[model samples]
Target: MMKWACHRPLALVLGMAGLAFGAPGAEATESGASLYLLGSGGPGTAVMPPLEGLYFDKMVWVYDGSAEANRRIPVNGNITLGLDTTIVADFTTLLAVPSTNFLGGTLAVGVTMPLGAPIIDAEGLLTGPAGGTTLTGSLHDSALTTGDPVVLTQLGWQADKLHIQLSTMTNVPIGHYRESGLANLSLHRWAVDGSLALSWHDPESGWDISAKAGYTANGDNRDSGYDSGDEIHIEGAIEKALSPKFSLGIQGYYQKQVSDDRGMLGPFRGEVVAVGATAATTVMMAGVPATFRGRIMEEIDTTNRLEGTSFWLDFTVPIHMNMPAG
Candidate 1:
């Protein structure tokens, strides 16, 4: 079946820059609750589920679709963030370092750059200090945000029936940010993420199951005066290979805010659960290897977080395997 150098595209959504408040079911705030989950890699993404660890190079792509509204907290009316008019993409390359093997395992590192074409539609009541309220029309703000780059490092070990990996992904705060705006692409904060995954594969039987979980620690946004909360996410999948080149499976994710938002927001928590389907395949191109994976997710349960559908397409092409050693 096809093998994927698992990577989460949600990490590329930039930081929680503008568009603070989440939908009704979602946690709305000016802190880290908007989205991005502090750049923590989501489930089915923190680790690769291959029977053998890959020591080659690869390039990846990703996309997300969603929309939400927030109103309960502010009586009159709330702000809504529609992602249908927003487009976010990530481009990354994973490279295997020469002699990166430890004992019998392999080590790899990758970097990701993100681009965003955002359409943030915001409208609600604005209350001034004089207790006067002004109703503003819906704002359809658009901006192209160049997101901060992400660095990912992984250590993987594989056996006959099981594979395990440890990973760390860090988000650098180098994207665009505006303290005042309907929406922004950059979170304007630093984040360090970690994950571990284990997978069991039986090639002869065409059965595979894998699970991964991750945690995130975030830095405070100076301009926004907000300290986003820490978060934990988990993902897992079960599948069967129909042929040497194809596989189909079920995948799901669960995320929760572990700590409370500080500095500018109260102690609030948000959580979400989603389940989806996935298909994977491998094809040869001009004697080169490429893999394609497609997935669709629907949120089943959510609190303080938006409930929406997300879809993604991943393409990985190996560039170079290894360098000559002295």
Candidate 2:
């Protein structure tokens, strides 16, 4: 059996958590948000634990970006231009892997809950009561709120130096939401995502390469009468461990909308590409082994969305380990 880091299961759960909530974007969906957060999956995307156990993971994400002055963004039943946004959020995830196997693979289930606040500032042109009269105004909104929860299930298999996993995630739209609230945290709609991940790790050489691809299908928001289109995302990472406790890597992601969104000013489709650097290390926490990882990314290219930078910090710890009897 191949041995992964102590919290490989936790890393797997964290990747799925990115599929659960809406992330601030230029104008991907209603209010310039999307269900899938880009660049969420980095290294160790398909790695699973050799032993069955329970694990916990937490991630903090920060983003700052803005749309072009010519772009029109729909928010709170109004069209806005020169839109700028900032977001700070955290995701808490818990995962459980049983000793039992399904089809020669380990089966795991997990859940993630998110809490965040988004700040939005925009300038808009409004028509006055008088004909052909235009008024320019600015609006700013910010509030702390809770986001929708996500549930995940996956089956993983390891073959010598290679690992593969199949996973599915669902969004539960029961978080803080308001159709007219510019700073709301929830999308107020259901969504589902299916993904496949692959990893190649050489224990002797300390090299790891991983990739993940997923598709998201979104449902309509009845309150806003908006229907977001389907989307696809791909993420990849290449890492080399310099020492047992530390490693450095490069990661990137590509995201694009595959369908057209309804109830928008026009046929709104979003696309973006981002690349970044990542680092990871292992440490002991209260006598338990834990893993810490950080990443910073910048959007080099974008269309119909905001172009900005994002930072991520993640922590993973195994709560319990169930070793098989000899």
Candidate 3:
């Protein structure tokens, strides 16, 4: 069953009993909307890592890069699309607002933009009526390159050793997309998501853990006449601080369709699970504090979705990290 996944697209023409029929469920997986589910639990997940109340008067810049690869993805009974050129490079900028009356917390405003795509290669085996075929090819298509831009707004509350937040992410559909394209980076529809996140810290041992859960409400793709499904995603991480400037941890995420995919074909579901390790460190440049984080993840299980590995490097630098201490 080829579900139009980012990792698989049965482009081959397979037949049963002399009847030519492409694979079933040849729908496009939620590549455009699925990017939001990559979050992993870690410190300050409940809020922008460096844009919390205590960090007021500061702005942060973040860069993320990731790639996914899958071998022999089934497209149909006789065809397959191999995925190799999957990569996403994203940039985000965030600013922290001072304390507010609501939840006695702070507000964070940010914008995240991604420049990349999902499908990179394709190989196929076409079975004809004569039952003889050997086929192969490669493709490089980046879904993220045409995907919409995301806006983030969240309220964060920090108390002693506890941190909590409520956030919303909105994706604007105004990127490159073709209704019939084998692979695309744009959803061509709006997606609004809400999330709750939490972080706990132990001052003495410098141990910490965090988690974030979110739900997505998607809109219809006018061009394709298809409505992607609502989705649920969870991200979490465990970490230990080696020093005030360094930390190491494990992080991961899981995502699944909550509502059946709507439109044209009507209602199909998809799911995926992934896990990875994380490492981070802080450096001072010209009296400014900067943070660098790197993570690698492996997709363990998936249904009607992409199956592959992913990794990213994140760098954050606060604009006012050089400000004088009180």
lDDT, candidate 2, at 102 = 82
Which candidate number would show the highest TM-score if scored against the true structure? 2
Query: lDDT (CA) for every model shown?
Result: 0.54, 0.73, 0.51
Each model's backbone clash number: 8, 2, 14
- Taking all chains together, the TM-score of candidate 2 against the true structure is 0.90
Residue pairs with backbone atoms closer than 3 Å in model 2 (clashes) = 26-305, 26-306
lDDT at 78, model 2: 51
Pairs of residues at least 3 apart in sequence or in different chains that clash in candidate 1: 15-187, 16-187, 22-28, 23-69, 25-304, 26-304, 26-305, 27-304
Q: If scored against the real structure, what TM-score would every candidate get?
A: 0.78, 0.90, 0.73
Across 211-307, the per-residue lDDT of candidate 2 in tens digits comes to 9999988888888667878889899999888887888899999988898877645457878889999888888777767888888999898877778
Native-structure RMSD, model 3? 10.9
Model 2 — which ten-residue stretch has the worst lDDT? 14-23
RMSD of 1: 5.2
After superposition, which runs of candidate 1 have C-alpha atoms over 4 Å from their true positions?
1-21, 25-85, 125-135, 263-265, 323-326
Ranking by TM-score, best first?
Answer: 2, 1, 3
The prediction achieving the highest lDDT against the true structure is: 2
Candidate 1 structure lDDT: 0.54
